[model samples]
Target: MRTAIVVGAGIGGVATALGLGRAGWQVTVLERAPQLGEVGAGISVWPSAVKALQQLGVTGLEKASVVSAPAGMRRPNGQWVVKASALGLELPVMVHRAQLHELITSGFGSGVTVRTGVTVDGFADGAVRAGGEELRADLVVAADGLRSVVRDALYPRYAGPRYSGYAAYRGIADVELEDGGGETWGRGRRFGFARLIDGRYYWYATENRAAGAVGDVWSAFDQWHDPIPELLEATKPEAVLQNDIYDLPLPLVPFAQANVALLGDAAHAMTPNLGRGACTAMEDAAALVRHVTGPAAIPAALTSYDAERRPVATKLVRVSRNVGRVGQLDGRIAAAVRDGLLLTGGKVAGLLARRRSG
Candidate 1:
């Protein structure tokens, strides 16, 4: 059996290990964390990610996810900017990040070996140096996240992730909303909330701020709307997770070199504007499994994986950055123009749909 070593046990890494194990490869997953887990925020798993999970034989995720109601952009004062019902948009299902991580980790099925607290020091000569030992494998799948050591080793000349000039705070609140939640936009900031499967509310806020700046999320968004303040109030101060948003530069870094492959953020980390980072990572896991499972050689399979995934991941990275720039407009005139265009565009699209139906 082909031997594979997967670094980092994030959602992508664990999923990749499961996929390779199912493909009859002996897989070992090395996670630096003491235990495999995820943060407390909720994840919006779109239809594409759901299908990818199904393809990987991970079941029960759908049962644990809540299909989102029609949601759309809103003004800071609670007026609808672009109603989802009018636009006829499909929303993604919301699942708690921890629950989703548990689901994926549980799918390992004894075929994959997981070693926690193993820090990979370096990758050289097709072998990984970790825990004072050099381990070689037929394939090395790097899913070590945005600050990936493997990526640094591969492209030393390339500067790493750039800050997106915004910081994000995410939390899950033990509160329920009568109306299904959506995002509210303001100058230089935005807040989004959604109901999770377990009845708690998941909300995130972004502000145009310097990296490592500390501020009060509740004070920033207290006057936005009914549930926005309520959600913030319900969430404990300690539960709020904050991070500066960062993404890789355009003309994305290559994802494959020889028998090694980069997965998820390790390959193309992006802003969360499109909510496609984790979704695309899941897609990457499935795609890697598809190309590497056949009778083809390991190097050829990695080449195919790189060829197919690079374009899609890079496109999303660009799109997500653009979306963030537009949504985070700070000037009054620019914000007005953006809001007007969104409203007008939504109305025109709705009219066109009605005309087609008529």
Candidate 2:
């Protein structure tokens, strides 16, 4: 049987290993951490990603579990900018990050082996050196995340992560919310919330700040609408997760080189504006598994995976970065112009939806 080694045991890495195992490849998962788990508050799984997981042998997600996109965009003052129903946007199922990770990892089959505390140091043709030992396989998959050592080593000259001139704060809040939550956009900052399946709110906020600058982020939204402040109040200060936003530069380098393939943030980390980062990574794994399990040779399979995922991921990265730029517009005049355009666009979209439904 063909064998594969997947570096990193995060959501994307585990998903890749599970898919390869289901596809009949013996997979060894290398996790640098002492144990297997995921950090973060909540994750938004889009429909396509859900199907991709199912294709990878994941189950238990009912069609009904998909929720409406947050009720649309709002102003920091709670005024409506555009209702989600108006935009007729595709919705995603919100889940706790750890829960989603567990769900994907649960699909691991007997052909799969996991090695924690195995910090991958470097790699060569179909082999990887980790923790003072070298292991060889038919294929090597690098899913080591944004600061991927494999990625860095492979393309030492590759211009890596480009900061998005802002930072994001995310948390799960236990506060009660009557209405479906949505995003509140303001000048140079924004706040969004969504109800998770477990009866809690998954909220995220962004603001323009110098990289690595930390302070009371809540102060910006404190005087905003009801429940905005309450959500923060309910979340413990330390529990709120924050990260400076970043995405790989456009025309992302190819996903495959020799017998190795890069997956997830290692390949296409993007700003969170579109909420498609993790979902895209899962899709990449599915594509890799599909081609590998097909009649094509492994080399051809890697080429197909690269061809299929790179273009799509490139487009998403571009659009998501553009959205962040527009969403974080500064200055009163700029925001007013943005709100006007959005309101007008919302009306047009709502009318289109109404016409279709009618």
Q: Which candidate is the best by lDDT?
A: 1
Off by over 4 Å in 2: 63-66
- List the candidate 1 regions with Cα displacement exceeding 4 Å: 355-358
Cα lDDT of model 2 by residue, 222-325, tens digit: 99898899999989988989889989997898898877889999999999999999999999989988888888877788888999999999999999999999
Location of the lowest summed lDDT over 10 successive residues in candidate 2: 61-70
* TM-scores of all candidate predictions against the true structure: 0.98, 0.97
Global Cα RMSD, each model = 1.1, 1.5
- Which pairs, if any, clash in model 2? none
Cα miss at 99, model 1 (Å)?
0.7
Model 1 residue 220 distance off true place after TM-score fit, in angstroms = 0.7
What are the per-residue Cα lDDT tens digits for candidate 1 across 1-358? 8889999898889889888888788999999999889765889999988888888878899788999878888999999988777766667999988888889888786679999999998988888999899999899999999999888888888889999999999998898679788899999999998998889899999999988899789889999888899999999999899999999998887899999999999999999999889989999999999999976888898899999999999899999999999999999999999999999998898787677667
Error of 2 at 145 (Å): 0.9
